[model samples]
Target: MSTIVRVAARGDGVAEDGRHAPFAAPGDTLTEAGEIIPGPHHQPPPCRHFPQCGGCQLQHLDDESYAAFVADRIATALAAQSIDAPLRPTALSPPRTRRRATLHAERGLVGFTAEGSHAIVDMRECHVLHPALFALVAPLRALLQRLRPKGRAELHLTLADQGVDLLIRGRLPDGLAAAEALTGFAQAHALARIAVDDGYGPETRWEPQPVAVTFAGTPVPLPPAAFLQATAEGEAALVAAVREAAEGAATIADLFAGLGTFALALPGRVYAGEGARDALLALKAAAALARRPVVTEHRDLFRRPLTTAELDRFDAIVLDPPRAGAREQVAQLAASKVARLAYVSCNPSSFARDTATLCEGGWRLDWVQPVGQFRWSTHVELAAALSR
Candidate 1:
């Protein structure tokens, strides 16, 4: 008999009925309104490790109910701020939309750490990633198993729609041999590109080739570590929303512009700003090829901002900031009286706060279109338009 252990429920100290079967478990049963679904299926197996593993908490619920729970979470967060928006249907994305993951390496084990702690989870399969990654996992594990380096830290895996890029934290046997091995792995798997990060390792060598990704009918080359949306479909949806909002606008300012995803696609003259030097250069290259007149400025808007004089020249503005949201910067734009402002935010709470600010500044809140970029998690990416 498999020894079943009871795990504590999330936020509740008491363990609920959920079992941790070694390889597989029972399917979660669901109940209709005012009806009780009886039997062993209804009796959930309690997880013994639930309190510790931060990976998942809703494992006991069926897939449909689990999705509703996720929607409720976002709705609750937004409701707190008195913002009412339609609860958009949750989009089911690949389990491993995680383009980049940081893993801990200890005692020859390479895997993700348990949710709240630094302890490894010993992950065999990630349900969220593209299915192709499952076949590549064994080879990745074999490669890591062969490597042993002193003072080893963590491994970072970045997967794009095109290829996989790795950032290993310790020294390898030899640079030439390691590069040859990575290239061989790529060819064997039919990968588009590969990047090895030995920046923290001894005798590091950095040689990166652009990862090719098609966007808006153009092949844009992105650096290995560059920021791209985890899901290509999600990015396309966002691009469509942005283009729709900015159509026929004269001069536009793109804030927090990474690789000019929106700037390169816009119809008119674009003034783009990004903190990353490499992203700006790549965006410039893409613009040149597309014959789009884009003047990019590499500026950290968080530290030094776009001046009022700079804001006065643009007829429309588009902002896509980091997860922190662009509260301070959005406030600046609200004061500028730009004709139409489109704000794209990954965090809904901050988006609500910032959008409220714009509303108070005489700009009308037009619509908030939600995009499921990170499919499984509580995160939401929204593109909202405000017209004065």
Candidate 2:
């Protein structure tokens, strides 16, 4: 006996079967049609493995569709705070934006974990990596299997235009031999450089050569591990947006400035502050080389925040804080004599909190635009321009 049970439907069209009737689920494995059609703004179905793969949450849709989904999510978050501004919709350039990735090295095999599981998938090719590095996956995996020095370890691999870096983890049976194998692999593969972090003592310092990217007919050399936007196109757009907003502003303060991405791009003298000594040193030197006027100060803005007195030194400010927004600093900047403040943030929740504080402190939200830098993930970078 076959009995079909019908569940109550809402305006959203979601049914009890957890499927939408109008929109069929993406794969051929599904026997029933989904009740909810993927909306114009909804993420499309691409991979059968959706929400499971921690690697890419938005892989279910094509690049353009995915970018819209991300933009809408950012819009919804911002609108909750009464911020009604035009969103700059952008397309995602998929299939090669990932510069660094960590792979699990198992018994005689090396690969990434399967969707939703730590179980390693012995992958011959990764769709997320650049073609040059993607083509080397098999050979690199074979090299790991032959070396077989550690037990259930992970390989941290970073690729740039200059070379590749290999940071090995876990216990290795042979230390020196493992190093030799890695060195040999690099030489044979024409990998410009190779490094090993065998959990040996302190963290090894890897000063990678500058990676070159063209912007406005100028070649920008970014430090290897410094904070550059994930995608090349995204960085260009973000830099242009900031430059346009800050064209004639004199004396800018770049808070949470990692390698002076905004500070160096801006004209006139800029004061930059970051918590990391290495990043600040590299940024200061690079600024000098580029003939850009940027003075960097290594200070922990989190623990001890910048005072209003310090904020008064700059006529304008740009803040690119981490996931945790610069709450206190935003309030301080709002109270200071600074006329305009541009905030670039990745986390909307933190941005909302900080925006509320700033608004109360006398700053008005002028506009916000979403930057779809990290294409496949739920994370969206936002650039907000505020004024007094």
Deviation of model 2 at 369, angstroms: 2.3
Off by over 4 Å in 2: 1-52, 108-116, 173-175, 200-226
Model 2: worst 10 consecutive residues (lDDT sum): 2-11
Task: Output the lDDT of residue 379, model 2.
Answer: 65
Q: Give the candidate number with the greatest lDDT.
A: 2
The alpha-carbon lDDT assigned to residue 140 of candidate 2 equals: 72
Separate clash counts for every candidate: 16, 8
Against the hidden reference, what TM-scores do the models get? 0.77, 0.80
Q: What's model 2's TM-score?
A: 0.80
Q: Give the worst 10-residue stretch by lDDT in candidate 1.
A: 6-15
Report the lDDT tens digits of candidate 2 across residue range 61-125.
Answer: 55554555556666666677866556676645466776667778787666667655887776654
Clash list (residue pairs), candidate 2 = 20-34, 20-35, 20-36, 21-34, 21-35, 21-36, 22-35, 46-60
